[model samples]
Target: MTNRYRSVFDIIGPIMIGPSSSHTAGAVAIGHVANRLFHAPIKEVVVRYFESFAQTHRGHGTDYAIISGVLGFDPADRRVPLAVDLARRQGLKITFIEDQGLSPIGHPNTAAVTLINAEKEITVWGCSVGGGTIEIRKVDLNGLIFTPQGPLPILFVEANQPIGAALDQLFGENYRRPRVTHQLADHYIYQLDLLDRPFPEQIDQARGMSQDLTLL
Candidate 1:
């Protein structure tokens, strides 16, 4: 597992504008990362809640919190409370699905968010373990796990051809570790956890080498 908790405050909790860190703040963090993975203007969103989240999402303001993050608002942003209205004004459609039986063996506070636009669609599965901490379990049906550390550069690459050598040259020195997941055939998902932000030129170069790529 990737350790992101840098200080006592991270373990304690995040400073956020919500009642419960797990239900609200963590949901926001999950949505935020999902947005980054999508990396495009969102036309619609479908958020599926499971177990504990399915039971009390509305009362705990999890709906608003997740939508707020999808709109690119941070957990501490004041706009969280008005996410629904803001999304409406921005012409973004949202749909919520609650399923208690979807993943009985999975974490209690789990959510699967699907982001869609005209050209592409992406799905992210996340779990809130508590104290505003979250783990991204899967992306686009591939099992790739990692925690979203604040301001840490994360890169997602999908390609039909092998690009391991390119990746090694691009991130071997600066990244802590790289998680690669095989999709169908020769396709792959390269999830790179970087120590620092890469240059814009490097990002552009990566974009040229893959079928799809996103950075966060």
Candidate 2:
């Protein structure tokens, strides 16, 4: 799935430092999401490229695009080109592999990434759909389809209790209610897009839901 472009901002392509949208901007978005999922300093990572990505990644700035994004640098950041050095200075280890787009990926411009932090490993798969748009196909092996777009805050909650009720209790019913969906059995996914609103630091009272929750 691609991000909905409601304005002409996307029509002219994003304002970023990149040579190609599919290879650079999209790749940066993919890595940005992966970093959020990882949720900690990335100690090590394995990035496998496929099809067009494998063939032309180095030539099109895909390598730096991803590295800079994970390091929390925006695409327009002038420091994007120095991402690899920055990661190395932070003791991050990265390995790039060329593959035939394995895993459950259906998109051609794909990169299956395994991001390792001190506590856990996050597996994320992303695909570039061209024109600076990309799709986050899956995370942690559970099939998901969403795009991280807009300035609004987005949160994904995986919980054992009724998160809808928790959200209502936390933010109030009159507030922008979260959209709920089912992930694995005994688990629920909550997506809240409150324009410019900030979430609290704690959301307890639901079994480890806040622990696995992701804020993007």
Candidate 3:
């Protein structure tokens, strides 16, 4: 794993409701980030747990925590305990699968969540690396890897055409250079870790650059 911890808070953990930070809070963080990356109203969700997460999810509230995060709830949200009921009431279908046979090369607290809607589907693979921290390893069938660090805003842009130059010009000098992943010959995903919250106009500019852009 890359050295993702940047501050004392990363070591100390986040302010969240938890029985175990790794299983509960970290799970929520992963789900929340996945939801953000999906950037669409989810109609269905399928979560596959691996190894440790597969064995201890129910007991550790990992299931509920993940559901809560998928519903766009933060770790400290009061509705976490009732995430299942809430999801049902909101017409969201959810399923859980325990795949203990998966390869154990990565973190033990790992899960792959698939979010589905009418137009598109997105799969996010993430791991809770303790202390309420998480690392998103993959998105869809591509190697889109990243870790959300503090207030740094992450913008995901997916497009069929080449928009890197436009993005470079739009964020020129003001933001950190983006990490780009080529998922297909003509399709790309740009992950930009911004120094500050982008202005509404800037976001609109990005959206205009590519109809597929989704700002987090």
Candidate 4:
């Protein structure tokens, strides 16, 4: 799979984290990207885990990793403990879904984050590629934009529902469902390729994290 998409290296460069870098730090990175995609100040986040993330997330601190990421913290930061409690205080609702069937096309370590601010709802799907890199697949906030369909670091215009609806109309059914795999390469690179790279910047800061956690 790696052979097929040699471009992945150009995507997510490096990262550092715990034993299961892909499942832990990488997953955390995915959550972090989702956090950014929400754009709005998140009042709540319902996190759904798939495959190994659901089964052993607790032991692996996958939940903590995700919550920290959603709170906009780095995966390698030791403040994750405090971040979890802080997120709760900030009114974030986190959940875990162990649905193997629902996660059809994603890396083994995948998650669906439903973010809400007031009555507006945003759903984001992401995958944690190894080494603390992420790929954001979907983002829909009550029809609001900021989707990967555009370009990475895609300009956040603070659009309204009506504009989002118009964008939706323009997309016309193509904006549904999140896909993160290259048929030839069978691997996910978080939001690297998913997000449009209008000004491609590859900063792999997660390099040493995986080694520290012995996730080699």
Give all candidates' CA lDDT scores: 0.79, 0.70, 0.76, 0.54
Q: Write candidate 2's Cα lDDT for 1-216 as tens digits.
A: 423444465578688987888898888888888888767767997888988899989999888888887887888889887887888888889999999645356777888777886577776678877777666656662344543332233566766666676665665532344354566567666665444334354434333545477655
lDDT-wise, the better of 1 and 2 is 1
Tens-digit lDDT track of model 1 for 45-87: 9999999999999999999989988888988998898998899
| lDDT leader | 1
Candidate 3: tens digits of C-alpha lDDT, residues 57-137: 999999889988888898888888899889989999999999968623377888888888887787777788778877666
Best by TM-score: 3
Clash number for each model:
0, 0, 0, 16
15: Cα error in model 1, Å: 1.6
Candidate 3 pairs with clashing backbones: none
The superposed Cα distance between candidate 1 and the true structure at residue 148, in angstroms, equals 12
- Residue-wise C-alpha lDDT for candidate 4, range 1-216, written one tens digit per residue: 232123475356444446566666766666676676555788777888877677777787777777877877776677764666788777777666777654543557678778777767777677665455555556654654333542223223221111333333332443233422211132212212222333222122222211111001
Query: After superposition, which runs of candidate 3 have C-alpha atoms over 4 Å from their true positions?
Result: 103-105, 141-154, 159-161, 166-188, 191-208, 212-216
Least well predicted 10-residue stretch by lDDT in candidate 2: 144-153
Candidate 3 — worst ten consecutive residues by lDDT sum?
A: 141-150
TM-score of 4: 0.61
